[model samples]
Target: MTTLRILAAGSLRGVWPDLMAAFHHQTGLTTDTQFGPAGLLRQRIEQGERCDLFASANLHHPATLLQRGLATDTGKFTANSLSLTARRDVVTKNDTWLSLLQRDDLRLATSTPLSDPSGDYTWQLFGKIEQAYPGWGERLKQRARQLVGGIDSLAVPTGELAAQWLIDQKHADLFIGYASYAPRLIHHSHLQVFLIPAPFNIQAEYAWAMLTHSAVPLATFLSSAAAKTILRQHGFT
Candidate 1:
């Protein structure tokens, strides 16, 4: 059996193994997957790196691949939203999620925009904040530290959650990242997880692209009930 080549978003790292195992059991086809920032992965594909399937954290990346003729088709498979992870000590008894974000004393960390969908979503959230409160959004954007998910960002230590690790290391007082990570991040005693509320939150739509005819089956499988169940188990919608 030929091994399928897959390029996936780093957000899927914690769940990919379970998903792949299920795929293999159902189809007997194995996969070799590479996980990274979706935008960077898309750049690799555009720069001549071949993959049978490309799973991105956002629909736009795979849709771009389809538009460029690099992919045969693209469709959404799962969804996620943003969350605010903060150092436990920073959150006060009276603080709401919005209050924490507006404080000048806190250091905000986000992924690198344009190189990661998470960063893109964070910026979108900022835009919403700006629309509601004049000048606050711009202040948040100006102060945010783009600490990871760039082409040259520091490598997160093996098996560590980026939000937790960054906070534990004193790199950030608060982090804005995918809510899918909240289940794990919440388990950390020193970290607090806050789901961004509606009207202010951005929904991240994960999309998959078929690079070749051979990848069609896998792509179809990914949209099945079994796959969605696995995704939900991992905190995706």
Candidate 2:
């Protein structure tokens, strides 16, 4: 069988390797995988990069490819929600979600907005917080350090999850990212994860699309029961 090339979102890094190994075993087709910010990956494919399958953190990227005639179709395989990862003590001490984030001295970190859907969801949460608290949207935006998933993000080597790395390096007291990544973001045993509140929660949809003219039919495999089981194991709904 031919080697299949796949470009996927960074958030799926934890599970993709093992999942694809299973795929290979079942189909006898080897795959070459690349993972990065979803939007950036989409841009690369749009720029004529060769890839058989594109899996993204949001439908928008694949939908754009479909409209551009770069992909045949798109289908959602899993879904995730935004969440906060922080030091256990810090989370336990805060009585309210907004208050924790609003603390004057606390440093917050998030993926870059517009470049990564996680950052976009973080911005949406800020907007909701602004609605509830009044005058805090701009404040939150100003204080958040865009550490990953932007045009200017520090160069993270391929296959590395930047948010988890930043948290491990103690770049900030808190990080905003996909809930599926919470387990990896906790650098220590004491780190904790908090679900984004109902009002601010954004369910991130992950979708896959077969590139136009690609010989590999990965879109159908993405929807298979085996794939869904692996996604769920990685925290996707």
Candidate 3:
């Protein structure tokens, strides 16, 4: 049996274990996986890391690979959105998403931009927030703790989600990350998940490409409704 090597985004970590198991059961093909920020994964591939498939949290990375002739083509297989995840005990009862984010005393954690799409999305959201309330964009960005993303995110322990662990360590009062990760933290950690309403929400687009044509079946399977159902069950919109 051939072991397909897959490079995927970190936020997908929560879903991949079971998803890969199901995929293996269905196709009888073994897989070896690496998960981290999509941009960094793209960098790895650019640096000549061998991978059979490339799954990214945003369209840009995979499209970049295709443009550079490193991958055959790309397909968007899943979707996600950004949300504010706060430690339940630390937030005030009346805190709305905006209010909580605006609090002067609040500490916000975000992924590192340019290295993680989640951070890039958070920056986009800051722009949207500025449109709603001028001057707040720069304020939020100035205060946000870039705890994850870039090469640093690659250091996050296996099976341990970054934001959840950060909250547990009292690093920040809240964090902005993929909504897909929110559900797991809420269930397993003392966290509260809040979806940023439309007008402020940044829609996250996830895509994948075949670095090696032999991995096409895995890409097709990921795009199928069966895979989508599993993703949705895990909180990916």
lDDT of each: 0.94, 0.81, 0.87
TM-score of each: 0.98, 0.90, 0.95
Error of 2 at 191 (Å): 1.7
Give the lDDT of residue 72 in candidate 1: 95
- State candidate 3's TM-score: 0.95
Error of 2 at 172 (Å): 1.0
TM accuracy, model 1? 0.98
Q: Best TM-score goes to which candidate? A: 1
What is the alpha-carbon lDDT of model 3 when measured against the actual structure?
Answer: 0.87
Model 1 regions lying over 4 Å from their true place = none
Q: Which stretches of candidate 2 lie over 4 Å from their true place?
A: 89-94, 156-164, 185-187, 213-216
Better of 1 and 3 by lDDT: 1
Highest lDDT scorer: 1
Clashing pairs in 3: none
Question: Which should have the higher TM-score, number 1 or number 2?
Answer: 1
lDDT string, candidate 2, 78-97, tens digits: 99998877656666454455
Clashing residue pairs for model 2:
none
